[model samples]
Target chain A: MFWNKEIETLSRKKLEELQIDRLKKTVKKVYDKVPFYKNKFMETGIKPQDIQSLKDVTKLPFTTNDDLRANFPDGLVAVPKGQIIRLHTSSGTTGKPKALFFSKKDVDVAADQMARCLIMSGMTSEDILQNMMTYGLFTGALVMHYGAEKVGCLVIPAGPGNSERQISLMQDFGTTTLHITPSYALYLADIMESMGIDPIKDLKLKRAFVGSEPYTEETRKKIEALYDIDVYNSYGLSEMNGPGVGFECGEKHGMHLWEDNYLVEIIDPQTLLPVKEEGQVGELVLTSLNREAMPLLRYRTRDITSIIPGKCPCGRTHRRINRITGRSDDMFIIRGVNVFPQQIERILMSTQRVGKNYQIVLDALDDITVRVEISKDMFDGNMEHLVDLQKEITGKLKAEILVTPKVELLEPGSLPSFEGKAKRVIDKRKL
Target chain B: MDAIKQISIFARNNPGQIERITHILAEQKINILAITIASSGEFGVIKFLVDQCEKAYECLKSEGMTVSLNDVLAIKLTDKPGGLYKVAKILRERKVNIDNAYMFVQESRKQGYLMIEVKDINKSMELLKGEKLQYLKKKDCYPRTKKPVKSSQSGK
Candidate 1:
């Protein structure tokens, strides 16, 4: 069975031996059935007999996002559409969403992985899990629901939004665990505070698993302080069978990758070559060890991270990856320097004068200017003081971001509010 | 001495407001020497220094734009390449720097007039004369026959 306890917590040598054994079997399975893998292996001149160990697996051609896009809908499915029990797709905000299929066994393995993640978060079988992720084509809600059920937890299938209803359910049902995005958790905290119920005191939430987007450490700290719950970062992609691919333990240093199910690789995004040293940030490439319906090999995730190869403080035998810094595609270049929106957010949260409601407007000028509108709460007293505050903010932004930003002290609530993901950066500089 | 006048008008932050203001002056053939706009999200204050101030004011207010007239400078420069640069250099030498300045080309006359806000008006005027630069005062730019409308409507 894939969920063997010996395999789950095997020694380093034993784990490698098992991984090679399973990998060899999985390789042969894909090579025989999957046309895509057969063609890929043939093109690379790598025969199934030559792949004796895991190291030889790298000889195969790497799969990319373009490959998924080209083979959209049902191009990559190994089994017929009728045999596939469930279908889910990754959020293709930039382009078309990549479709993922799961057989009954595939679904069970995914659920077990998620259950292992929840168990690491200190969730008990008696705990109630409130899943705030969206249901439907999205796998977050369903995968988490099944995983929590596997752990014998009372599952609340209440999806995203309707904070009042969620609070009511939490109060009524004594919900002890929450599965939500960081932004939604912040929104919940804000709502609870306005309703005169202290979130830390009122909610019986023991742990929160926040994922789905790249959030800064400052944001996690703020959420933790507000709700007084241990916020664990869960990392996964729909293309890789949703939210239980890997999870952070109590140490919170990095998320331990479920190496048994997926072989995680860190490669330089541009070169597509393996990153030699540890702590060097690179794009994540994933290969499913047991995915039968549609197994992806060397699939570039575009998420930039470094691996912590040593044994985790949590005593898990699986390797850990540092919290994702940002994605290569999401990077914005200004004045020849690459900038990520999360970097600006981190700097903004660190500053005392600037609030969360900020818009970085890049105009078509020789000197790139950033107009940051400070929230009204950051401002007190008169105009002169506000100007001083603006100068202070501008100086700090320059020091950290290495660019001078034009700071504007706007009246409280001058910026547009977001109901979902906050649109932080506005790049007006068109190529 | 030719007169120069500064006018401040209240305008909504919608499309065609600028076009309406420009249309009124273009109808009367009044030349706009320089213009500046200070705007928030919803509204803007349009400040203009025009050659024919009184005629421009009557035309603008007649178009229902709330306008007010004030005194400013209209310094003339040669149509040559470095004319504006020489004027700025002279002012910098005299320590009579400009706080704000705007300009436009006169297509028919082949000359450029600069409407500038200086640190000190008297010092700027003295430096202009000292440097042999020609300029127009507020009164000289406007004709006395045209009168502004006296209404209870405050532009603010």
Candidate 2:
């Protein structure tokens, strides 16, 4: 039943051999077809033949986030424009959007990879999957749509927002699986509770695929408890065909990276050296093996995660990766303490009456001022309730980050609602 | 005391925001009968008693501004030096809290009206009724409604 039986179950020795072969082909193809890769290769003095083994991959130059953005639209496509059939743009929350091109062959291979991910994550032909990720230039919706269709799922292309309609569609269609982000899933759970609908009793959702942002273990547990469904972590990026790179197995442990499709590496962001010890946290770097329209080699994904060493009881030989902790670029130091926004988010979410949005502003003052939106229900009480909440959040933050922070309780919906990635932190010190 | 419809507009406390909304209302020939602005840091609230409450709220909302309409307290103030102080003194004695208030006189300058929001609407109205306070009905300011007032002489 494996989509690519031989590739998925390849032994470690054989998998590395396959990775080396694909890495050589990708390096050579990009060097000949794309000028950017060629110039980088010339500057680094590394030829395609120089990569004799997978270990030699360290010699290759890393294609980074800035490089992709600098090239912007249509700069990195190795194939002709006519050959490229689809394009997905990065969220570009802060700067210019980076374009990702996919040829028809690339699309098919991505679909195949996604289909394999779905089957492995307990999707069946009889299951009706509602793809709730926002559609259009966003890659989450369409990639999952094609993959679920490949698995013969009756797909409900319900885009994001309109939580009532999402729940209605679930009840009407008897949807069994969903493709959505972790935040949206929790948001939907909240909506369900407000609507007096018990999801476990009213819906048929058996499992979900949650990713595109780093979430905490608490959120995972809360979402699972809320919906009574198993949540599987799915990881991918726009540069690497989106949302099908690695997937969690039935073991509910680490996600197994599709080694035949991508060569994965965990490296220290500062030293840029691979972490030899498995399960050590580092930035995840990936090289697409099968992508044709745009072959990105040694592309720095910036996602922080660890390599989960050891065998999966699911019998899949593909190497596993731990859940993404945070982005390497997303970390900020406050009062000499390296604080991640996700860490703040985890603390905020675990507390009661906290809304879906919070803003951490680091300005001229060295300390951070966090404005947390108190859910609507809490605002009806006296001002003391808010002062207590502020104290509670401040105390928890101090306990979590080891620094006392200035916390303000804002009314719900005071801050901007993000349709894609939530922009929770604003480092105004730069501004 | 009559509660006149007052619309509160929530706008970012940035330059050109008040000018922006006033311009939009001016384009529609909507007269701002009374206005008061309150601000806290980067955002503020502007409450107005306009000629057309529904029209102004709809147009502003259609233009994508966060605006709301509430029937707040509106009463006529004697066009004299201690008129507002007298009303405030009586209300303070009764512990009738007024959340916010604004007053304006028409071009005639002989009569003025005050728009206010109180902690308890019924309590404030009851305590201020025996003062022979002149409460401005919505029609006095709007002139577009069909409701008839019990006494035209009540604007005493």
Across A1-431, the per-residue lDDT of candidate 2 in tens digits comes to: 46667777888889888888888898889999989989999998889889888888899899988899888887788988899899898876678888999999998888989999998987889999998888899788899999988999999999888898999999999998988888899888888998999999999989988876777677788888888899888888888998888888888798888988898888867678997577766789999988899989889988887788789888889989987867888877787766667668778988897787999999777789888776644333223344567789999999877878888766456789987667878898887
Segments in model 2 whose C-alpha atoms lie over 4 Å from true places = A330-431, B1-156
Write one digit per residue (lDDT tens) for candidate 1, span A1-431: 12335656779787777777777777777788777779988887888788687787677677888888888887788776777999998867678988899988889989999988888877878899999999989889999999989988999999999999999999999988888998899888889988998877787988888887778788898888888888998788888888989888778889988898888788766556787787556678888888878888788888877788677766788889888877766656677654555556556667676566777767777244444545433332223344566677778777756778776544335578786567766676675
Q: lDDT values of the candidates?
A: 0.75, 0.81
Candidate number with greatest DockQ: 2
lDDT of 2 at A288: 91
Per prediction, the TM-score for chain B is 0.67, 0.83
Q: Compute DockQ for each candidate against the true complex.
A: 0.02, 0.03
In model 1 chain B, the worst 10-residue window by lDDT is B147-156
Q: Pairs clashing in candidate 2?
A: none
RMSD of 1: 12.1
Q: Show how many residue pairs clash in every candidate, following the order shown.
A: 3, 0
True contacts kept of each: 0.00, 0.00
Best by lDDT: 2
